[model samples]
Target: MNALIVAPIVLPAIVAALSVLARGRRQRVGAALSLAGCVGLLAIALALFAQASGGAVSVYTVGDWPAPFGIVLVLDRLSALMLLLNAGLALVVLVHALLTGVDRKGWHFHPLFQFLLTGLNGAFLTGDLFNLFVFFEVLLIASYGLMLHGQGAGRLKAGLQYVVINLVGSTLFLIGVGTLYGVTGTLNMADMGLRIAALPTGDRGLVQVGALLLTVVFALKAALLPLHLWLPRTYGGTSPVVAALFAIMTKVGVYAIIRTTTLIFGAQVTGPLMLPAAIASVVIGFVGVLAARGLREQAAFGVVGSTGTLLVAVALFEPRALAAGLYYLPHTTLTVALLFLVADLIARRRADHGDAITPGPRFASMGPIAVLYLLAGIALAGMPPLSGFIGKLLILKAALAHQAAPWIWAAILGTTLLAVIALARTGSTLFWKGRAGEMRHGAVSRLDLLPAVALVVLLGALTVGAGSVTGFMDAVAGQMFAPRGYIEAVLGQAAVR
Candidate 1:
């Protein structure tokens, strides 16, 4: 058993508990400690990625019990990559929050933030289905506290809707879990994966229903269209820092979908059903993006659109396609974080000028900032030379190779068109046009610049190193499509079927 497998989950839990016990100035110290813990998690995740790259699986069984009887944590390429992304982003956001003095808003912020990390790490690491639910609840509860941090009627009302929708999703998740367990007689994902594949055709229908239900639950969390009514209101109404944190939150649901589909439901029977749902997500997401207005609302709709695109990538269910999905996941996460940060800066700048946004006479003023915004926006829209382009290319290649359903192409093309329109609109409104008033200079703190710079630099690095990154993604794609590696890591050779 690898000790590193559990560190990510435990470190954040301990930090959160400690933060809750601290007070006053000590709270900042607690926050620092939490940041340090996330740093440690990032280091561990990178190391695990290196280890997994050598074609080895790292497993940790909680309390020394065997798989299917005890909670298991497995580290494979996909999970390790996601762990690194999640921890890295959480660390960056925490530093941004601390530097910006957003931490001072409430004494509870540090503790809640830490708790959310704990849940995120736990969800990514856990090997049991039920444990996944528990970790999700941990994160959800923390998110509720974070969402409602500085009370206002607007925030409260929006948050209430968010909470209520998620609660329904959670209830459905429970039902899915119960049904799966009742059918398989176990909740450990690896064990269930083995057993589920062996069930007779008639009996497998229940498992399919359960899997679809779970997909719906995660889609709600990912804020896919039709189920995404609460995202804009909730995220737009929250504090900018919190909204940045949420940029990662929605991806967690995407992560769950990817993990569940590729790992637990990749059997022939279940894979087909998932394809249709993925197509629907893509179509709806694109439409939402086109229909949105305003900066925040547009970004919110972009979130839905991006989710759809990624889902389509996954639905393609080919090595190249899944690789593209994995690659795009972190890219989208980083881009969204940067976009939200930009929006926050824009809003702050507007507020400084007596709540009126007026651009200076120089059309090229703020060129550097505008470039950063354009790069991020274009990347989100899948323009050439960006990470999104590379990701989409891989998916397109895979879809053509596999001769996927006709609707797959239709959805992909429609989504691309809508994304173009949406991003074009954002560019024209946010960068091209100037408002009629004096330009006011708000205090652009280093805190604000830190996350923006970090995200932009990260995107640039990915773009420049696309070849090597795509190679790594290819390896991850191979491993994910063949579940033997993950299963063997979590459950020893004895459990391999």
Candidate 2:
């Protein structure tokens, strides 16, 4: 169990080091090795999940040190589930990158990808708040390299904005952490959680302020509403494969928000205040989507809106609601990645013939591709029988059970309508219209087709198995809310009660 907790973090780091040392043909070999590492991490995550399903928690202390003094990795049901999702997504993206010849273009890509995985795995497993921040920085640095990976003017320009915004967020994160340490005198999350529960009511205000700052930092990363101005531009400028890799990055921010709200501030001062903010994000995100006429831009805004919806579910803080949020998390991540990849495929095909990939009047003529676009559009809009529908239904049911504010209901309805209209407009321009110039036909490479097919198949699987997945998500949610199992594993029985 201890090795399982450490494997996800250590395996990636080891592979990344190997990737950095490899050259030429060995680079591809390095990439293969990295993929193998990801597979190992995925298996370990699954095993952790199985073990945690018995309502137990597993803890691993680095360098054989104890909690609060030594760095600790804790895996309960929530962490195990998130680790599995991250590893799976990383594996798929890595495979897509190799199949598309991205690794062949640059030696650095594989190492950076592996390092990014290292950060993600570490972030999910860490029981220390400061260590979580350190992992976040590691991930951010690797992302900076990946975002700038082809080194073009557009990429650099976009990367600058991405880096600048995240740097500010990172600074704020540090300040928040410092403030938290000052107040609680501890950086271990489980220890902090216990201490926080015992703090005098008056001093809770200081902790709430610190939590709010941390929330802002994470919300910025999640690209929620006003903080999202950087996302569409950044993602729009990057290559499709890089954009796909980033699909999980933004979700990591949302994941942090969920973890913090549930474990650290559960039913505390931070949860209630976040609800209205979540509603505002939902409204703002949908409006942004409606305002975007371009396909790439629209997809970017849709990502924002979906993230906002998930955050709202988190803020609701009901067991069923958090369960809905958990279910929605993976669903949105997969859908967004697929949509971005599909957009890239269609655009690349257009570019091959010296035609504009950006949707114009000419795109309406591509009927077969148009169907794919429509399916993605429908899925994004939460249409029935899709995974999106299942996620949204769970959230709506929970919202009703809680009898949430009328404005929240209004925001959800309004956002859905706007998202539908925005997607329809983008689809019509890209798929339904015809360009004025001569049409050129080009072969769709298997590289492109493979990702699209895999995405569709995965979505289909999710749709068919939504019942079982939701049940698992619900169980994880229950584990997260109480988290006594997690506390015991990290601090032993002496520290828990």
- Residues 197-315 of candidate 1 have per-residue lDDT tens digits of 88998888899888888888887888765687788788777776787778878877877877787777763544665566667767776676666654565566667667777877776
lDDT of 2 by residue, 145-178 (tens): 9988878898899999999999999899999889
Stretches of candidate 1 exceeding 4 Å from the true structure: 267-277, 352-365, 402-410, 435-437
TM-scores of all candidate predictions against the true structure = 0.92, 0.92
RMSD of each: 2.8, 2.6
State residue 425's C-alpha deviation in candidate 1, in Å: 3.5
C-alpha lDDT score of every prediction, in listed order: 0.77, 0.78
lDDT of 2 at 446: 52
